[model samples]
Target: MGRYRETYERWKASPEAFWAEAAREIDWSKPWDRVLTLEGDLSRWFEGATCNTCWNALDRHVEGGRGEQLALIHDSAMTGKVKRFTYRELRDKVATFAGVLQRHGIGKGDRVILYMPMVPQAVVAMLACARLGAIHSVVFGGFAAKELATRIDDARPKLIVSASCGLEPGRAIAYKPLLDQAIELSEHKPEACIIVQRAELEAPLVPGRDFDWKDEMEKARAAGAAPACVPVAATDPLYVLYTSGTTGKPKGVVRDNGGHMVALKWSMKNVYGVDPGDVFWAASDVGWVVGHSYIVYGPLLHGCTTILFEGKPVGTPDAGTYWRVIADHGVKALFTAPTAFRAIKKEDPAAELVKKYDLSKFELLFLAGERGDPDTIQWAERALGVPVIDHWWQTESGWPMVANPMGLERLPVKYGSPTVAMPGYEIQVVDEAAKPVPANTTGAIVVKLPLPPGCLPTLWHNDEGFRNSYLADYPGYYKTADAGYLDEDGYLYVMSRTDDIINVAGHRLSTGGMEEVLAGHPDVAECAVIGVADALKGQVPVGFLVVNKGVNRPAEEIAKEAVALVRDKIGPVAAFKTALVVQRLPKTRSGKILRGTMRKIADGEAWSMPATIDDPVILEEIGEALSDAGYGRKG
Candidate 1:
């Protein structure tokens, strides 16, 4: 809190000064002629500065005698194996992997798709691309064959890497088999499909198409090339991260090489308060941008000890597994989703034994996946004896926009507000006409000007798509489809997506708020709310809940209980019309509940899924539940 308090005051007092100070951390080929010059839509930061971010991240730090320091702490739950690497060790590993890529004909600007899980080899592949100046696109490990094929078609990488399957919590989804299926469909099968054997639960590697990962690594070591950092421009494409396909097929958000590095490093330091020697863990799959930015880029660039686990936070081992790992590792600062937090908090709090370890070493607890409810924030504070700092950002933003800046914005355990925009960001809540809405009024959230380092330059292979998605709807600003407001204190309180907001009897409601309340129920495992159209009023909220195993009750009874909880917690205006209890919520491949899809089902419309959802069958069950509840029954 002390660090964050100082940063918040300093940044708020003079943002330009705050950002200028942070910019000095970047390895600039030449100092900026101006820190930033804003004229029209062109807001250039550190104009004239040039340098490869890879140099700063991998080379410069090691060259200066941090070589032997631990850089990554990678583990695989499926295999019960762990690999620890130092900066010096990684320097060589990256070289070896880069050499293997060269042997496979991967080179500068060549797209390489990595569809592997959060194993050490995955990070090796990422750094290998950095070493060779190749563009790497990481498909989330959970993606099905069709989704994998879609991204493969879009990127057309020279090489693809995967294990036979992906393991999360209780199940192992066969990744190599899925990749094989994708390759069968793809006209352009990557020239070489590399296989890594992580979970020995799978069969032996395919003979011709697959090579043993250890053998490949050994071969690269036998024929070594001097590891050279890729000479990339600040504007060069660093990564192409696909967002959760909310509107249509997933759009690849292209983040620039240097800018992304700069933004991530700064945000990790200032926003998340990541510190050297700290064990950082963000429990998100590699497919989503948060997973890419926090789980991989920012923490690695900052040289923090990052934990990359290949299984679910709550896997077959149970919900207590995460807390046990935290206790075992003595992790100082942990970043995770509010959805996960709510679930973990529901578990026998007595079983979440932070006291088993000396948890006093920890100071920061970060939450994302919608601004957490106040109860969640307070609950975390009480349970962890640490403040639960919430954050809000999108795939296009590259890094966090509104965050409880570490060494800066520390607040009491209140929910809803993410935080004020960090230094160099111009955030506003505007009405439909693009006029700035009055403070405390919910409106369209937008970024008014050019941002700090790490913003996505464009969408992968889609210039018009980029313009249409972010810039077209709003004349000049970046429109965050989520509706939110700023209090007089200047802290921004973000809600779920605009479509997720329910206007019940003309009273506005955020689904997050209602879901948070529902989560307090012992029977609920997870829940999603959607606004169904009302003939007279406008829209009323309806909930679809996934009941926890072993907890069975009449839907009507639970529905009545849910309404009372919301009415008491957030007032009567946020009332729900119906609560359809189900076994699972409709979620995308990335685990984001598609409220828009739920909304369609609630409205009795034929469901047309966005491209991201791996499982479309859950919604059918939900619809069945809804129909049984008389959702579509005519009087």
Candidate 2:
């Protein structure tokens, strides 16, 4: 009867009903005849449809009385200032940028690489590309020059977008320096780069090849031509996101328009419970699918005010940066990773930063990225007096599957469920054979039918790569490769990744379970527990840690307490093979620690394996600490 019920019914009535209905809410020059068509192994939603996602998300919102209302709130971490952009203002900016692309022969289906910080304009540029019907590939802002260049070469985008200066944890890095390097690597770099000037850093403008973003916008406006309407089908490519390749080269995962729009718009309303006036902050960089969905397209299409803050969550002056922005903006919903929760919990728990901000304004606190430790969620809820939601999804599936329900959070968290496959998604916990697993039994988490938005259609340039990585592993079902068990209530509790599980004497334990134990300790700030090769136990868990900044305890003592904490939390079998406290954990830019690298460190090898780690130094730290502990002598 209401928005939630109607939305649920609309989805349940038919597999493709929800997206078909949502499509009507947007502007369409031409609409599809059928909702979905399944032929052979392929499924298409809104087949033969024609519409512009950017027009629905931005331009139409400006025309629909919500134009003057703020749609994006920029909370600058480096400057400690907040900037607001209204729907109308956003539309104009996007139109201007789209115009810039038009001037450079950029049109429908062209690839554009947005390698910039989490500033407001970054989102603006992304939407602008969408408006022009171009496929965007946003490289993680923290990626070194080499990583950025790799993606640039992969997509072969015609343009590379960067800020004159961008925010980093401790200080601003000269972004153009990296942009220059990426340009050198880009096979299809534009004749001129568009710089979203920020940080007030001195312009290291590459002579004759870079253009001021603001000035270019003025030029586009002065020409005053009608916005170009590039002909594109509804199912046209929207983005190509690159996930870290477990093998050598990263794979570019491509997502189509119709599915992305429907899945994200619906998830935003039902999952985050995003409302018209709500200020949402998906504290993820634009590089990942999370940013593509919640941060950019989803929130905008829902007609909500969202935050686009640039800088690290922990050290933007202090650990309180996230809290301060929420209070200042009265952000109603927040989505971040467990990595941040565990990492920040290492800071002064009762510091004045806690007392300085009022988090009561936020209605929902959501967790994704990695397993949401029940321990972390509970502490955050208690400290902030708000229910914390933990959701689970992947780069491949595109949209959230398991999560705290956006429109139904009051139902009470089931502690580890991703909230029952989300409404339109068909999620299941299955065995190695891809058959459904019984309740309370751990197995692979898989999606059944009708892939949701934010889900990649295929690997950017490789079709079989997508099928092999996601579809081929478990035929007929998109195997997530994450292990989990569904509770009696159908709540899915994701264990760590399949490789992240530990089997010792027939007892299987998740890294999350061990992490929950390590985090429960009062002295422990943050830790990583990885299963390592052990001839006796088959495989055992080892703890690598970063203690609180000023803790006077010696490394050996911290390691001792860490093991005791793990033992107490689970059982004696949870003991570490070798516990080492390090200066920092090696993590991807997204805050996911490189556990595979940790596993290598425990094997007493040189840790020279370049398989999973972005940085090789974290392995070195583990090696030095292990050497000092005399673990080798004990062997």
| Global lDDT scores for all candidate models | 0.73, 0.75
Q: How far is candidate 1 from the true structure (C-alpha RMSD, Å)?
A: 3.3
lDDT of 2 by residue, 417-514 (tens): 65666666667888777788789888888887556545666787777776777788777877778887888876788877899988886778888777
Over 4 Å off in model 1, which ranges? 1-20, 29-49, 199-210, 246-250, 349-357, 503-509, 516-526, 536-538, 545-555, 567-575, 608-617, 632-635
Top model number, lDDT: 2
Residue 517, model 2, lDDT: 71
Error of 2 at 224 (Å): 1.8
**Model 2: how far is 122 from its true place, Å?**
1.4
**lDDT tens digits by residue: candidate 1, 1-635:** 46655565686677567666776777766665665666455444555566666566667768878888888777666667778888888778877888888888888889989988777788888878877778889887757677778788888888887776667655677787788888888767787878887544464666776777778888888877545776765666877876656344558878776667777878776677767667888877777777778777787788777777665555535666566657656677888887776566555444354455567667778887755766667667887787778888888787888887765545543466787677656788888888888888988888865656677666887877877877777776887898878888778887778877777777777786677788777566667777777787788778776666556578778877887787788876775657777766676655577787767776777767666675778767877876776664221
Candidate 2 ranges with C-alpha deviation above 4 Å: 1-13, 186-190, 225-231, 245-249, 505-507, 549-558, 573-577, 604-617, 629-635
Candidate 2 lDDT trough over 10 residues, lowest sum: 626-635
